[model samples]
Target chain A: MTERKREILASSQSVLKEKGYAATSVRDIAKALEMEPASLYSHFKNKEDILKITCFDMADKFELAVREVNDIYFNAEEKLRLAIKLHVEILTQNLDSAIIFIRDWRNLTGTALEQFLTKRNAYEKGFREIVQTGIDEGVFNETDKKFAALTILSSVNWIVEWYKVDGKLNAEQIADKLSNFILSGLKKEMI
Target chain B: MTERKREILASSQSVLKEKGYAATSVRDIAKALEMEPASLYSHFKNKEDILKITCFDMADKFELAVREVNDIYFNAEEKLRLAIKLHVEILTQNLDSAIIFIRDWRNLTGTALEQFLTKRNAYEKGFREIVQTGIDEGVFNETDKKFAALTILSSVNWIVEWYKVDGKLNAEQIADKLSNFILSGLKKEMI
Candidate 1:
């Protein structure tokens, strides 16, 4: 992408983060970029198109983070911890992208919508597979894998809503707490 | 409230739900109610006042639901389940109010913001007390009580994002599943 294109996407993301997706308009983006409304047309088709791109880009980054974390760990417990850390780190660093992913993915329609749903489900399935691995290897409890996945994902996803820029809690602290809580729930104890 | 005042608030809520709080202007509410903008001033000082009333109404209903549920349950487990059930039921039934509570609470300034925060935090504290009681009674495992409270709240709170009007899972079903998962985490092993 050209510098201008990146700038437009970045500005659009900031606007979306501050005002949300539905409130954002082409005129708003153009005003933020200090360009005529038509200038945005050259880079992206419309507001919907920009949201679609942002959602897709966020999905890609999330998937890449999962893959990178998986490569670094072989144990199921360590993999789970690292995956949560990677997700929280990436999300905290690029909060705009995370907000777009959570808030605007539903705004997408037609083929763009389909593409996002597909990628999102695949990403969720990746997490589910890891949980299943932990369960089968006796590292995690034998529970409903899908529900566990959803519960974990929900907790992680809502972090973007409450994460503070200047707060004392870092991504690693959150990751450690989350991973510990989840593992404790899954670990078998002596009767 | 007078009949006209009630109608105005209801219309404001509907408009705010369809078009978020940030985007819903005073004119939009006036148009939705088929009244002149000047007439709305008789009921509300401005858009922020409408939001303040709406948020207060939402917080009241939420607290009522929690209190009603807590009154009927003697055990921590049952109280927790009832609390989750009522929270979801109230939210799903009045998605508009829920949306306003979730999204526009921050738009409130000054005394209104402080009042809403106080009520919201107090409401949350009710749940935290229930969790702490469970831990003291040896029904729940040792964990950060406040953190667990937030984790459970976040998991239940995000249901509004994925829940559907015609989806296979109704509000009751979703609430049941969530309550069950949360209870499972808190329940002591019988072995």
Candidate 2:
């Protein structure tokens, strides 16, 4: 919550992304932050602890985005499009945390790992609920909801791998385009 | 590739998927194959070498699948759909190699790594050409070809992460569902 803690978490995410969770150390985070390893210890107990905080922070962000979308009184089709836009915004906006969250969350062990998976499944379930709503209302195609949800999430999750600071499309445009692409797949009737 | 060489590659890919590229050692692969480390070395100089072959072998599978689809003279939409099915079939049918190909390809280095990137670009280009053909023929939406291609590829690629042999959808059903989702994104209009 503090300014310095945010910096440490940000640096940890970056170092974890660059060196990978297995290869990264608190010292690497300290080096990237230009701080003492002891200072990092004061903030986080260990590398796994650092990863735990980072991973949970990412989960919180994803959940928060989903919650924000839920506040809007829109149809399932509009809700999914807006929720996807929010999800992609977080990923492209905070690129480092996005990459580390997707790639290195596996490195978290014990309760941290278990909780992360639980939260992730819940987050994906939110998407699935939307797809089910669409299917029930006949706004979207009546196909396998799990398959549809996974397809949408996978396509968006992959943006972190290919997104660039100066790509052909900005984050908003890319989100719009991606939302269009995904929504087309779910639309009841093709245009 | 010789029978024994193919066996080595197959075991290497499975071990790499299980233990990851960093943790899996030559001894691990040898243990998996019930072969001595020296015998493994006669096939691959080291773990990285084994990884190189496995990655390229997966790439070859991808290229071979695309080639088979190219033999058909369907419209771009149908061509792209069949190509996606073949691609997913290769991934789900050869599950371990598909996971390794997506996850562990980052661990490759040197000329093998460079050549792999080149080949990957060419493989993507193959897909792009199909999309372009569809766009030219007025069968597909005139969107950013790269973004559309990347969307289709990413959705299919992530299947290696969630697809199961005994899951709700069989390989053929999954391939069909995914192809339908993706083609819906590209088609000019509903039939």
Give each model's clash number.
Answer: 0, 0
Per-residue accuracy of model 2 over A1-191 as CA lDDT, tens digit each: 78988888887887778757765666787888898888887777777887787778888999888876766778997899888888988888888888878877877778888999999998988888888878887889888788788889999999888898888778788788888998887787833
Runs off by more than 4 Å, candidate 1: A25-44, A67-75, A187-190, B1-56, B68-78, B95-100, B103-115, B134-146, B164-176, B183-191
List TM-score per model, in order.
0.76, 0.91
Measured against the true two-chain complex, the DockQ scores of the candidates, in the order shown, are: 0.32, 0.54
Choose the strongest candidate by TM-score.
2
TM-score: model 1, chain A: 0.93
Worst 10 residues of 1 chain A by lDDT: A182-191
lDDT of 1 by residue, A33-148 (tens): 88899988899877788888889988998888776755665777777877888888888888888987886676787998898888888777878877887877787777767777
Specify the CAPRI tier of model 1.
Answer: acceptable
Error of 1 at A112 (Å): 1.8
**Local distance difference test, each candidate:** 0.80, 0.83
The true-versus-predicted C-alpha distance at residue A138 of model 2, in Å, is 1.6
lDDT of 2 at A65: 81
CA lDDT, candidate 2, residue B50: 75
Chain A alone, TM-score for each of the models?
0.93, 0.92
